[model samples]
Target: MESSCPSTPRWNLDRPFLTGRFHQEIKGTSRFASDAKGCPLDSFSSGLENPIGCYDGAVQELIVIDDLLFALVGIEGRYISIKRVHGKADVFSFQVDASMDLALQEIAKRIFPLCESFLLIDEFVESGSQFKNGLVNHALAAALWALLLDYQAMVAQLEHQFRLRRLSIQGLWFCYQPMMGSMQALSTVIKKVSANNYAGSAVLNLLQSQAKAMAGDCAVRSLLEKMTHSASIAYLSILERVISWFILWI
Candidate 1:
């Protein structure tokens, strides 16, 4: 019998969001030289397993795409504030608010690419942030916020459609479970990431706790694997289990 369970989902986000040609072009490039020089952290290299050369590699990479995302966040946040400020302007409020809304909508287009960059860094960067706990936290927070914002938008859209009699309640719930499962999976990893100090003992404890938390949930098993595989470089072996049990449960 052909198994319904899929093979592990490779970080296939590279092709769509990250161009192989561009990735090749950027490799060995010194475009990020100044930012890399600005970082004074010691190099972390343990054989081929964990190798971040004599600068803050994450900062170097962040200079490329991460800074852009941060700028987008600031732009969007500023426009949001502007919209609120003009909310009380009675005379010209309508025109001002309309303009602000349009600007905010334009900025909203960048969110998906920002989310994609955070999700698919494994493809562009050879090694994940094993030695850089700060990098891990920054990525986690960005990814988590993006996931939450997406979930909220989805729920709001579904509810609006349901109120308009465009979707059945049953259908709404069915569509919602996957989103719920994805958020739950994200929360589980955030718990692991939130360990006060990223020590070996902390990682082990997180591994045990996550195993228990996910014991019977087949829906999120694969999603959880993807999240941890991408984000948890140091604990990849411990965190990403074979999904045979997930297959069986389903």
Candidate 2:
């Protein structure tokens, strides 16, 4: 009888957001890297196991694809993706059960809240003359933010309809490498936009364009007006911290 406990053997994103032991253990598993024939299971035997999850060496078609996914996904949590992990000709459409899905959500909710708490709560203090948000100083804040965003991306993938169309870029959460450099990639994208012609406020135009491109394969989420107002209030608050500093100097 197959165990109904959601065989997340390789994806136990259970409680902790990140751990060093998880990274060390995940380094071994075999991934679907080639057209090789055999039980993919045998490939996983020797690898070590970690608490976050164990892997059998998740492989990919080209090294670049692995790197790309890692940058896109690994920043949030530890990932080990082998493109053809199960010998399936098709990639993507990898479905996780509802239980696994909800567990991942729970992690995001609990751990990620630290960020909002720091930013919104009164406990954090101003850093220096520049008035930096105390939240940024928390070592875990960035990790928490990464975990939150990555979880959202993973959830975004799950929220998708996995029809057989071109193995869409789902399953990004499992792609991993130490320091995947997702931020650098994101930074470069912004730099390119700023360097382009008509740079002023063109950023907004560029975002609109990109949003249009993403709309083809993604759903647009609408936040309630109250939510929008709350977000704006927070942004204004972050900005106010800086503004207040400048005002003090003036």
Clashes of 2: 11
Please list all clashing residue pairs in model 1, or write none if there are none: none
Candidate 2 lDDT tens digits, 107-187: 233222222222221111111101122222222223334444654475345334223222223333323221223222222
Q: Highest lDDT, which number?
A: 1
List the RMSD of every prediction in angstroms: 19.8, 17.4
Which ranges of candidate 2 are over 4 A from the true structure? 1-34, 39-41, 46-212, 217-235, 248-250
For residues 210-230, write the lDDT of model 1, one tens digit per residue: 655776876455555544444
TM-score: model 2 vs. ground truth: 0.25
Candidate 1, lDDT over the whole model: 0.35
